[model samples]
Target: MLRLASLKFGRLFRYGKLLFAASLLVVMLLNTHSLFSSFQRNELTDRRFLSLNKCPACFGSSWCRKFMNGQLSFEGWGRLRLLDFFNVKNVHFAQYGEPREGSRRVVLKRLGSNHELSELDQRICKRATGRPRCDLVQAMYKTDFARLNGDVRLLTPDVVEGWSDLVHCPSQRLLDRLVRRYAETKDSGSFLLRNLKDTERMQLLLTLAFNPEPLVLQSFPSDEGWPFAKYLGACGRMVAVNYVGEELWSYFNAPWEKRVDLAWQLMEIAEQLTNNDFEFALYLLDVSFDNFAVGPRDGKVIIVDAENVLVADKKN
Candidate 1:
C-alpha cells in the first residue's frame, strides 16, 4: 500500500513541475516579443527623419494625395512617420500641416477646422482619397508643416488659452520707439532692430499685430471656376488657421540671424501692405513674424495661415 501511494505522489509532483516550466517559457517569449516591438518602433522613428529630410516633395499634393489613396503608405514611405509628433512639428512641408499625437494619428489641424481635426482630416482624406488600409494603421508616420503647392493647411479656430499669460502687450511708448526706428530707416535691410530691447521688439510686434489671428483674404475669380471657392469655402468650417511658423517662433532652433531676418521681413511686410501693390494683394492684417516665412526662392515670403485673409476691397 505504501509503495503504491509513493508512486501516485511522484506522478503528481512531476506533472506540476512540467506545468510550471511551460508557464515560464510562455512568459519569456512574451517579454522578448514586447522588447522587440519597442526596439523596432524606435529604429523606424530614426529612419523616418532621414527619409523625410531627404525628400522635400514628400508633402506635396501628389504625395499626400497618393498616400491618401493608399498608393502611398499611411505609415509614411521608408518608415517616414509623417504623422509623428516630433516630425510634424519639424517637417515644415505642408501648406496646412498638422501635428499628430504619438500613440495614434490625432490630427490637430486640416482644411480649416481644428475642433475635430482627427475626424476632419480623416474624413477629408477619405473623400479625397479613399478608405485607409487596415494594415496601414499599424504603420507609423512622420508629418510636418512643410510647404506643398497650392494646398492651404486649414486650421480650426480655438480660444487663445494663454491670453492672461500674455502680460506683455506693448505699451504706446515702446510702439512709438520701434515704429519710429522702422520708419526712419530708409533701407528695410538696415538694422532697424539694432537698439531695441527684446521686450521693446516683441511689444512693437504685438502692437502692430493687433491680434494673434489674421483676418486676411485671397482672391478667387468666380470665372476661374470653383477650385478656389471650394477650397476657401471649406476653410469656413474651420474656426481659424495657424498663423505661426515653427521656425518663426524659434521652436525648431532656426538660426538667430535667420530669425532676425524673418522678423525684419515682418516689419517690411507691414510697410509693403500699405503700399499700392497691396491695394490688390491680400491684406495680411495680422502680420506677425510668425505668420510668414522665406519662400522657396530667397527673399520670398510665404503666408502660412490659410484662412482669415481678406481681399483688398474688403479692407477698403
Candidate 2:
C-alpha cells in the first residue's frame, strides 16, 4: 500500500511541472509577439525624424509625446496636438500658406474649395500647393499672447492664464493700449501684414502700432473683397478672443454658445464705453494665448481665425 501511494504522488508532481512549463512557454511567446509588433509599428510610422521644432507643447516631454501619439486622433484636436509638438503657437487662418503634413493638409484641401471657404478667402489659402499626407487635425486658427509692461510683465504661461481667467473682461490697460494704437495707424495703411484680408489686415496693422510685436495674419492682396482700412476709425472697444489651443476646460470653460453670448455682451460693453458702433471678431478655434508675444489690437476685435465664423456650405 505504501509503494502504491508513492507512485501516485510521483505522477502528480511530474504533471504539475509539465503544466508549469507549458504556461511559461505561452507567456514567453506572448511577450515576444508584443515586442515584435511594437517594433513593426515604429518602423512604419518613422516618427523619429519628426522634430520638436514642429511641436513643443505636445511633444515637449516624453509623456505628452506618448499620450498624443497613442490617444489623440488624426483629426480635429489630434492634428493640433501634432503641430503643438513643434511649438507652433500661431497657425492662424489668415497666415496659412504652406500645407503641413498629416490632417492639416487635408483640411487645407477642403478649404481650397469654395464650399467651406469663400473663393475670396485669400487670407488662409495663400499657397495650398504641394500639400503632404500626414495624420493631423484640421487647424482653423491659432495664436499666443502675453502681457507686456504690466504688473504681470513677463509673458509666462502663468501670466497668460491669469489674463484668460478673467472671463468677463481683459485688463483695462491692455484695452486702452490697443485702442490708442489703432487711432495712430488708421491712416498709415501700410504695415508688415499686407497679406491679411480686410478685417484681418486692419487688425494686423493695428496690432503693429499698439503691440509692435511680430504677429501672423492671413495672406492676401488688395484686390480681395474685404477692404477694412477705410472703415477703421468708426469702431469702439474690443474683445480678446481667449482660445487656449487645447480642448482642456481649464483654458476656456464656456461652451461655444456661451462664448458667442459673451462676445455679444462684450460688444454691448464696448458700445456703452466708447459710444461708437462696436465691431468685434471671434477667434473661435483653439488659440494659444501664450504664443502671441504682442499685445491685442484696440478698437478692432478682428477674427484672426475667420474660418470659425463662416458656416461651411456642404451643398454648395
Candidate 3:
C-alpha cells in the first residue's frame, strides 16, 4: 500500500511540474510589452560603439586599397546582417568611376572608414590600436549586437499587398529625373522605362523591395556586341536605374518594431543579392539609405542606385 501511494504522489508531482511550466510560458508571452519597453529604454540608445573591444576594420581603407590595386577584396566581402544572424557578401560596386591605375576596368570606391570608437561615445574604453587586422575583423564578425527582445511584429499581409499605385502614383518629377539618368546609359536594350505607365513603374519600384536580381537579369543584352559591352565595361552596371527612395536610415528613428522591420527588410534583400552571380559575375554592393525610398501607397521600400553593380567574366 505504501509503495502504491508513493507512485501516485510521483505522478502528481510530475503533473504539477508540467502545469508550472505552462503557466511560466503564458506569463512570458504576456510580459512581452514590458520586455520591449525595457529594451528601448536601455539597449537601443543613440550611442554607436565601434565595438565592445579592439577589432580590425573590414570595410576600412586597408581593404579598399586592395580593391584599388585590382586584387580580390575578400576583406570587404562579409558584412554583418542582424536578421539572418550571419555575415554575407558585400561586393563594393565601383564600376563606371575612376579607372584603377594599371587595369582598364573600373573598381569600387576607396572610402576611408574608422570604426568610430570615439571618446564620449560610451563607457567602454577605446580599443587598442595594435591588434592584428584579421583578428579584429573576425571578432567584429562574431559579436552579437541585438539585445534579447520579443519576436518582431510583421507588417500585415493586407498592407504588403496594398503596395500598389492604384491608390497613389510616384512623383512625376522623380520619374522624369530617373528616366533621364537611365537614358544617359544609352543601354539600347534597357530603355523599357520610357514606355511603362505609372502603375507599371510603381510596381517595378515596389518589387525591388523584395529583390533587385530580376531587374538586373532582365537588363542583360540579347545579341553579343561592343556597344552594350562598352557601356557596361566602363561603369559596370546601369546606376540610378533602380534607386527610388532618398533616405531609409530615418526609419531607424521610428518605434522599435518599425526599426526591426526596416533593417530586416533591407538586409533580407541584400542577403538575396549575389555579388558573384550569373553568367557574368554580378556584384551589387552599393548600399546606402539614400539609394532607397518608400511607395506612396503602402510605403513599401525601393532601391534607386544600381551604379556600383559589377559584371565580370566576358573576355573584352
Candidate 4:
C-alpha cells in the first residue's frame, strides 16, 4: 500500500510541473507577440509620416511641416501596454509649436479608427475605379469632382428628409456658406487647390466629404465665439486641436453646485446652437459627456468632438 501511494504522489507532482511550464510558456509567448506588435506599429507610423511629408496634397501645410521636422513632437507609437490594446480610436497627444513661440499641448485625431479608415479607402477606390484594388492616387485622378459636387447638392435637400449621409442639411446653402468663409479666411483649402494636381485635389475634397469637422471648425472658429475646440491644423487624415480640458465625465463627481452650473451651461449652448440668428440650425446628433470638456480656466463647456453634428438650413 505504501509503494502504490508513492507512485500516485510522484505522478501528481510531475503533472503539476508540466502545467506550470505550460502556463509560463503562454505568458512568455504573449509578451513576445505584444513586443513585436508594438515594433510594427511604430514602424507603420513612421512610414505614414514620411508619406505625408512627401505628399503634395498635405493638409495644414505649415503644421505638417512642423510635425515632420520635429518642431512638433509626440510620443512614438507603441502598444506594448495591455491598456493600449483597447484604444480603438486613432487619437494621440502631442506638443504643438516651438517652446519659444508658446508651445501648447494638443490632441490629434484621425477622425476614425484604423478599421474605419481602411473601409473608407476601399469604398473610395471602388467608387472611383469600380475595383477595390486600384491605385489610390490614380483612382483619385479618375474621380469626377463635378459629379461629386452635383451629388453634394442633391444630398443637401435630403438631409431634412433624412436621406443624406453627408452633411445633415436641406439645400446646399449652408455648405456654400462654410466654403465661402473658409476661402475668405485664406485657409489651407485655397492654397491646397492652387496649382495642385487633379489627383491631390480630388483626394482632399473626398476626405472633406467623408469627415466635415475641418470645414465646421474653419467656418465656426472658436475665436469667433463658437463653442468648439480651437483647430490647430491637420496632416493627412489626422487633425490637431487645442486640448480644452479633461472630459466632462471626469467632472461628474464635483460639487453639486458646480455640476448644476455645468448642466445649465450645456442647456444654454444647446439653445444657442438651435436658435442662433444664423440661417442654419446646428444640431448635435451624438451627445455624450465624453464628447465635451470644460475649459480649464473659464469653466466653459466646449464641444471637443464635432463629428456627428448636423447643420439644417432653417430657411428651407
The best candidate by TM-score is 4
Measured by lDDT, the strongest candidate is 4
* Candidate scoring better on TM-score of 2 and 4: 4
Indicate the residue-level lDDT of 226 in model 2: 21
Instruction: Give the alpha-carbon lDDT of every model.
Output: 0.32, 0.28, 0.34, 0.63
Residue-by-residue lDDT tens digits, candidate 3, 1-316: 9999999999999999999889867865787676455434321111122121232221111122232343321112211112112212222322122345532322232111122222212212123233333344333323221111123122122322322221122233322323332322233233345344332333233222223332332354312211111112111111112222335766666788866777776665554343323333334556677556554455556554443444433221
User: 1-316 in candidate 2: lDDT tens per residue?
Assistant: 9999999999999999999889867865767765454434432122332222222111112222322243221333323322333333323211112224322111111111222122222322232222332221111122221113123322222322222211113333333333333322333333222222333333332233222221211111112322111111111111112221222223256578755654564455334323322222222233333322211233222222322221111221
What shift in Å separates residue 93 of candidate 2 from its native position after superposition? 18
Tens digits of per-residue lDDT for model 1, 228-270: 1111111111112222223344324667776677667666655
Go through the candidates in order and give the C-alpha RMSD of each one to the true structure. 21.0, 21.4, 22.6, 7.8
Worst 10 residues of 2 by lDDT: 227-236
Off by over 4 Å in 1: 1-109, 112-114, 117-246, 251-260, 285-289, 295-299, 312-316
Worst 10 residues of 3 by lDDT: 233-242
* Ordering by TM-score: 4, 1, 3, 2
What is model 1's C-alpha RMSD? 21.0
Query: Which is the winner by TM-score between candidate 2 and candidate 3?
Result: 3
What's the TM for model 3? 0.24
